[model samples]
Target: MNGAKVDVRKVAGEGVTWTLLATLYLRAWESRLPEPILGDRYAAGAVERIDYDFAALRRRIRPASNQFLVALRARQLDDWSRAFLARHPNAVVLQLGCGMDSRMLRLDPLGKLRWFDVDVPHVIELRRRIYPERGRYTMVGASVTDDGWLEAIPADRPVLVVAEGVLPYLTADEVRTLLARLTGHFTAGGELVFDASAPWVARVAEDFRWAPRDAREIERWIPGLTCADATPFTTHHRRIPVRRYRALYRLIHAVPALRNAYREFRFTF
Candidate 1:
């Protein structure tokens, strides 16, 4: 990975697309720390090269408050992805709403597994400018909700669908339809990993559309879907650098409802 040639502000602009930059910035900031969670050097390098109003964006989003938390979430997802690849070396991976995440780079060093990073056209274009194209790696420039993108991916192999900070932005119907399409298309059976907020959190965050109190609730929406694991950030509260945030997470983890309010979930079908 090298420095970005295009200006992210001109490409991604604001709104949902801009959130990708925020995450990239957070990962880069975390990587600079003495002890980092994700240790994404590619993200740090991209951040340094991309020309954008990062300071203004930071002030607007106030992303620093959840900096470590963001890195933790990414690290957890990466771990799950690595485990999936370890078990099924030839599995196909679909990284939905990939943004500018370097997950494929981090996990697929040997380029053994087929990997596809799915996102909108503009984001994909930006990614092209930043990252080098490699064998067994393809960038799909299409919305996750779009059906056409799936046609290009091979359905013969088991699929591992990974979505981080994506499902919340999609409507419940959209998510259900997308999952149904995926499960129906891939008969080999695979896993789905993503994070979701609680209903109350969704209500508070006006932009978010879908929230499930329980991961198993998804099984009702899509037949054959089983909740394998649901873990809250508080599960690793000890890793938090700030004492106050650690204490807060501890309290949140104590309550079943609160703990599940915001967490990552793994589902198998």
Candidate 2:
């Protein structure tokens, strides 16, 4: 697997929004939006990608499961973000592995909280064209692994770390290192929120097939992070026979039983 070549910058635009995973989630959210939020171009950008290649993405990602999980995780992440902002209005909030997400606008904090979006150089470069970095919201074009930008985050206030649909891309050891860095640096009550893919997804992503190339890589070398609270995000799709589960089953080329093996987990460290 060419895990080494999976450019972090590719994570910025269509690689994120153009996939079945993101397109399906946006369609559902757009359908539910009240007119006031429509003017927000972040959401519009994602929806545009979907409208552009609705057919190709749908064919590759095979929507049903990806859409359900992404939307569910979005709710979890937004809720945690807004709650933290309410308490530590001046807190530093980091969105790790933030793709073309509308999080800054969705969880618009009312105070001096510094919201930083951290991703690879290419992704941040693309984002620069769309969202301007203001006093409150900022963009960092550094890979999460490198420590150079850790200083960019305020060491004073507690940081609420958020990773949605991101952890799976990294190898287990890298994930552990990232978590240890976060917890060791922050005080208690400063939490990390992120999701985990089932071993099934890891199996499919063995070569970055549909997900991150490193999914399988991390499982072996790195031990899982042990946190104050690590719980699986428990919510299932409407009950349907295994044969009928569309999205989960679409990756049959790799794992034939992948359809019956759908599972989602969310954890903190």
Candidate 3:
């Protein structure tokens, strides 16, 4: 499937691409627009091509970050990360496999920072159509596994990597390879921030969590990289008791039986 390009126009552009939360975030963006909204909204009045009850989906997709519990987490992480980038004006920040996240708009960095939004070519292609890069924000169209893209990025500068809802879909080996490659290339004091699905919790996420990927084997993939427990609020989202929020989500979705539903981890390179 590598290098296979699906003409953005020709894909089965009916429902969502199954990137779940990211797609929902995009939808929220569109909901703010004064339309002729020509982005992902389909002819069927559906944003995602998936055949689900959109009404039901809308109610269930209320992100915790939108709530007090998750809102604190979001501000904490985003503020801290933005501050870090501010200090490392020349540092390279990579949002690997970024789907349709509006982090660029949120961070809204000026020309001093060098930021990249990296993902599969098609996603970048799609994002470009909606949100064009202005100055410092550039979209690097490549997967995290492909080192070829790294060549275009300056290795001399420190790298700050941010990944949200990405690794669980990868096999552990793929996760490690990506981590090793990133850490190996980063300058000292560089950091990578991301969250993980506790093994058991991650399994349940395959269906409920919405994004698809190759990250199921995250533990086995890379032999190194420290897991600095970052459960408390480090970014925009604060850490809720994993069990508490998972239960809330379960009860919110009426799936309370799901165990170990929320897990998180972070580390430096």
Residue 16, model 3, lDDT: 29
Tell how far residue 241 is off in model 1, in angstroms: 3.5
Off by over 4 Å in 3: 1-16, 20-73, 207-224, 232-260
The model with the greatest TM-score is 1
**lDDT per residue as tens, model 3, 1-269:** 23333333543243325453335444453434343121223212223332344465456555333333333333444655676677776687788767666565666534456788887776676666555687878998777777688767667887778776566666655666777787666645566776554445555554433222323333334444555544432222213334465455444333322322343345655
- Against the reference, the lDDT scores of all candidates come to 0.84, 0.55, 0.54
lDDT of 2 by residue, 46-129 (tens): 444422444555566654444444554565566666776677776788888776677777677342567888877766665665
Global local distance difference test of model 1:
0.84
Q: Best candidate per lDDT, number?
A: 1
Candidates sorted on TM-score, descending: 1, 2, 3
Worst window of 10 by summed lDDT in candidate 1: 9-18
Per-model TM-score, in order, reads: 0.93, 0.66, 0.65
Using lDDT as the yardstick, the better of models 1 and 2 is: 1
Error of 1 at 24 (Å): 1.0
